[model samples]
Target chain A: MFSITGLLTISGILFVAGAAALITRRNAVAALMGVELMLNAANLNFVAGWRYFWPERLDAHVAVLLVITVAAAEAAVGLAIILNLYRKFGTVDLEQIRLMRG
Target chain B: MTHAQLTALLPVILLAGTAVALLLVQAITRSHRVTAGVTLAGLAAALVAVTRALPQGATPVTALLTIDRFALLYTGLLALIGIGLTLLSFLYLAGRTRLTGAYYILFTLALAGGAVLASSAHFAAFFLGLEMISVSLFALAAYRRDDPAGIEAGMKYLVLAGVATAVLLFGAALLYARYGTMAFAALGTAIAPGAGDPLTLAGIALVVAGIGFKLTLAPFHLWAPDVYEGAPAPVTGFIATISKAAVFALLLRLFTQVHLREHPALFAIFATLAIASIFAGNLLGLRQMNLKRVLAYSSVANMGYLLIAFLAGGPAGAIAATFYLTAYLPALLGIFTLLTALSGRERDADAIADYAGLAWRRPVLAAAFTVLLLSLAGIPLTGGFIGKFYVALTGVSAALAGSPAFWALVGALVVGSVIGLYYYLRIVLAFFQRTPAGEEPAAITRRVPDAAAIVLTLSTLAVLWLGVLPGNTLTLISLLVEEWFR
Candidate 1:
């Protein structure tokens, strides 16, 4: 098994990069991709946690399944919105769709 | 066979059975009125089930939910709130829209989902119930399929909710890795002493972030304003009251069971988020003109207050949070329903100036608005005030016991309450503000009011009832929570 420090270092790096991509990406779809990456990085940590902590229960597997299912749902819905955004304003740039700014 | 178990399962079965039956009925008859009528009946039946189970409450349903007076009471509140929205929905869709039966289908599904969420126990059930509610909300928010805004809002919700679910799953995964179990009770064995590793802590942090999005705590609350402004008023009402309260119930349950006081880091993160949300929500709301957007921001702050209850911790925290949710549902749903009626043909009711001299023009409707506004502002003789009082007392007392984080929470709640008053009172003020003597009587083709809504407009009545008779509600809540904790 890899050292805890190694596991943590990888997770930390993945998290920062994912968050950066999510924030900086102009395309809503790209931003969504960034979010998915972030969730995956966290999943890595979750599995690592299962190995190190509750090796017997492995409940983390259940959580992983839930994340995957929800991610799919998010993709379907987000893409639908993106399609609508294109139809209406003709662009997917987050900054451009500010008409409904409250 | 236990009374608590039976009672706890009552609403779940009733709601699930009803939703399925309605879906089937829609397939067979395709009548809008019948679908809505059946949904209303199902919710009423669930309410009856809860009342019946109250006396012998506090039963654990598969260790996923605690069936006590608390869950029953919350279920009853959801039932009542659903009644108003359902009443308004049928009339509105029948009058203007074409998807009559489907509207009630989504509406009842959302209500059932909310009820299940508030009463959920284990993480599996909790997450499932929340998704069930949220997915329905997405469809309802965009029920006006022809309207681009409706469709857009639903998409945003679906996407963001997707992210949140991911975060929560990560968090839960971490917990499972550390403890080898997904049950809330099983958490202690993993973390109390030996399991309190960095992985466990990190897992909890992820879960916090995930739930935070749902709570619409600032920073993560990007979609709320747009979603609120874009969706139909009744759907917004559903989002604000039923959806928001259900999440709080989930939080309270999770924290209470997890022994939140044991996690200082989690508490600190919650404190930071709460303070940020309170200020951001209030400050941002100041510039908003759209009535729905304003309410959405208000929800962000209102959630911040509920977090204060969590910061308080223990039975007092539980009691205060529950009370606030009870008051919040009616007031929010009432305001949205009122906005719906005032919107006339168009769906947009954004400007503060739209409601000039409403008190003079529509006295009864204005009276209901006044009650909702007063309760929201925590003014005297309203449930909002009492709920605020409980939260404030609990927060301050907890802070005195050396929780500096809770002290910050108390500070945030006080300031936010003051700032929140301006916007709510602004709306109320317009009700009395006369239109410069003869100014074109502010032409508005109001949506025809529903008679069934009058039975549910207990928004005004709740304010007076809870405000004047707070002790009874408080006593019952205390008893309910006391039993739940036991």
Candidate 2:
């Protein structure tokens, strides 16, 4: 059911779309979600690549697992930072947070 | 596998263990002084480890870390800066702030991160090294929680850093995708004897851009002034010395191993950034009324000077870059520590007027500051002068004689430097500028920190010791320099 080609196609589309959303989304939370999506896409790519290219290589799976761990950490840190934005400025809008723009 | 391997790892081990030890000590002791003492002790121990490991020299636990002469030299310098900044933090924090325990922890971790960066050879190690350095900096920038400027600096750094991290990761991934490996050596193998595919080229550019951001070179240098202005002075000192040097060291590894010389476009891009950073850093610095911001811009321009050596990526070039950073670490810490001391409890004690008539009030401090500034300007007999002299000589020598890019680097250096001298001298003149009418209360003197005094002594010794007799240090550096380009 989880063919390599199918996984790769889905991951590629998700990644390209997620990246586009990250670049285009105006909402801060949406942008952050886009980041999450992008990260997940990378995770998908890793797993699919593992299955297709090196299915028996434990390190490939391990590397992807490590990235997931780091991604979770990144999300936690990013959300904490966004909490400050929500409290201070009463908006989760990335565009509005441009208060200190150079 | 070898003692050399284990020995090479001493600095890393000392730092990690000390961090754990100090954290435990603080949890139990609840004393900032104890924490500071522990932190200083740790850095000192690490410095000793670095020195002992040198002469006999070591490699890595694996190829992840490359503990050669270059790593030792830079790691030693980072330890010195860390120790100096940690000592300065005592005065900066003593009764003036809270979270001393956390502050010392972040300080030690940042130093360790820098140490890792100086020694890293693989992408995995480089990313970890950079994150270790950067994550702490995010907290350190906002160390003074009450100040909005502190928060602002922190946010800017975080967002910009996130962008840079993403870009760098994408770059690295592209390179890996093309080459099937992440090791610097493997990447070098992939690119050697032929041109890199565009994917690899783009990857290098992204890596360079990420590094360019970290180093605060032009177009990528937006964060320097604001961050420097907002962050506590000692944090600025860390940013100025360790962060910049470590990133450059990593960049040196990437370029030297990748045979970047074969790529004309990449070379031109770096050359352009160097030129732009020098001019923009100088030009923008002139308009700043804030002292920290002035130095921030000046440091950016100095990065341009370092880039000149780095661009060369040859024996003389690598030596020049490392040697200059060695000289820079001390004079740099000296000036900022002096500023931090002069500022008292107020943050950014950097308004131009704060320095007015400083010479009359604090002659010794004022004169020492002047010498340090003069060193930054590359004044004769100062370590900075020797560093800059080598950079210019190496840059001109390495650049293809008729290439526009080559001469552009030269022209930018000359012009930016001349323009730069004006702003640097402005503060010098302000020190002499007759107490700015109605004499605002004498710039409050915070109790001179004993740690600061020690750091100052260390930095001052380093400045003059090398300024007067640099032959020994230069010889030591050249061993790595030879290895770098060979």
Candidate 3:
């Protein structure tokens, strides 16, 4: 039986992995993917919470749906921004785009 | 929804409608003047709506939003600032860009997001509102596509803010799993004082981290200076004022409901963040030559100071924070208006040297800039002084009320202010210093736009008025905060 603790443990691992990827990755697109993974981990937690803990209440389900919608919107805007960065710097490397450091 | 609920939501709805209308207007005709005028009218209408709805009293429009006097006060304040920004942006964008209409639409949408944040009572509303603001800002930050620095700033903000949002969501999911509800009121009731469930504590910590990122509190403030330096002057102002203020409003509401004062561990966490932000901001600010980066650090320190009042915890603390925010907004916006007016075709005039001999070139602008800077530094005869005074008063009272920890925060406030003063005065001194022979002042290459001049004059007047006669505003805030607690 899939337990709430098991679900939370998986989500926790996913979150840490995503955070690690974000910190280590230099490519802008790869970093974006890391963010997506983190968001999806949160989504999974919401769905699992709904199924295992509170099937009567739809709050978790609603939260999951809204999170997905916002994540999609964020990804779209993020990719467009990355594309713009590429056009300007001719590469999407975060390290190479350091033009305004103090 | 009932009529009362609908009326209570009028201001946010009006802002969203205006954004949609602007989209249609852009499709038909792309006149910058017309677009800006429409935006100004919409903002004014929303401000009026907020004022009109205030008398109806606190209305919980569903579980998602609570349109109380506190929310109305901030919503109205945001709309007023939105109007000022629209006017300044019109001048800032007039000859600089071809697609100015889209800028106003994004601007209006961001304002809508801020309004929602000010009134949100549930996690879902909070998440949605936060994203609305972030998504709009990501686009707005990169609006100047030709500028590589702007694009980089946008990309950095996107990646960082995206992660922050996800962290916040995971936290919310944890809370929901624990309590089966995401409503602030419900969560507040569910989590008892001194409760130490590991899951709940982790969730709360993650949530704080997410918000700390937005507020640019220390340890989470890495992106602020670079983004502020790269974004357009006006957009940077939007980030400083509306974005920070709205999120802070939500933070205050959420934490107060959760009785943060009763949770010693959580209280200590916030206190640490506050102290770290103050020292980090001030020490880092002292070394920055770029004016924008200096202002960014100043903002970080200012938010830290504001958190002192928030940590004080009571009606008095709430009132002090609101008053301090009121006093801060004009000073920040006025400075950016000046920056926007000084920017030329090539790039923003953000270097400290750009202001050399401004007193000799434009005496009135220089004087206004000095007043705004003095206000920021909490010098006497400016609103910032009174705001700082109230915050210090709250901190002292909290210290006396058995929380000696507040003494440390109050001490940081004092030291931070002293360090803050040097940089603020350094900027002011630059305004008076003579330019070397054969080297022209770079800030005045463009004629000051009339709209920008008006905004500067108004901001200066507002700051001075708050400083000289703050009794009425203070009383008003106290009453609203008292109502909020009830």
The per-model lDDT (C-alpha) reads: 0.76, 0.76, 0.90
Top candidate on TM-score is 3
- Which candidate's lDDT is highest? 3
How much is B111 displaced in model 1, in angstroms?
A: 2.6
Ten consecutive residues with minimal summed lDDT in candidate 1 chain A? Answer: A70-79
TM-score (0 to 1) for chain A, all models? 0.88, 0.86, 0.93
**TM-score of each candidate's B chain against the true B chain:** 0.94, 0.95, 0.99
Candidate 2 achieves a global lDDT of 0.76
Of the candidates numbered 1 and 3, which has the greater lDDT value? 3
Clashing pairs in 3: none
Question: How many Å off is the CA of B92 in candidate 3?
Answer: 1.7
Question: Worst 10-residue stretch by lDDT in candidate 3 chain B?
Answer: B437-446
lDDT of 2 by residue, B1-486 (tens): 777777888898898788889889986987878898899899899999998888764465675888877888888888878877887788778767767888888788888888898888877778778877876886777666566566657655665565565556556655654565667887887775446566667768878887888988889888678778777888878888889988888888778888766788788788888988898899999888888888889988999999988887778888998889889888999987877776666555667777778777667667787878878888777888889888988878766654456677877888888898899899888877665445643562444566566666667667777778889989988985675545
Q: Output DockQ, candidate 1.
A: 0.46
Prediction 1: B-chain TM-score: 0.94
- DockQ-best of 2 and 3: 3
All-Cα superposition RMSD per candidate:
3.0, 3.2, 1.0
Return the top candidate by DockQ. 3
What digit string (tens of lDDT, one per residue) describes model 1 on residues A1-102?
A: 697568756866776676687668778788778778877876776677767765775556776677678667656656766777677768888777665665
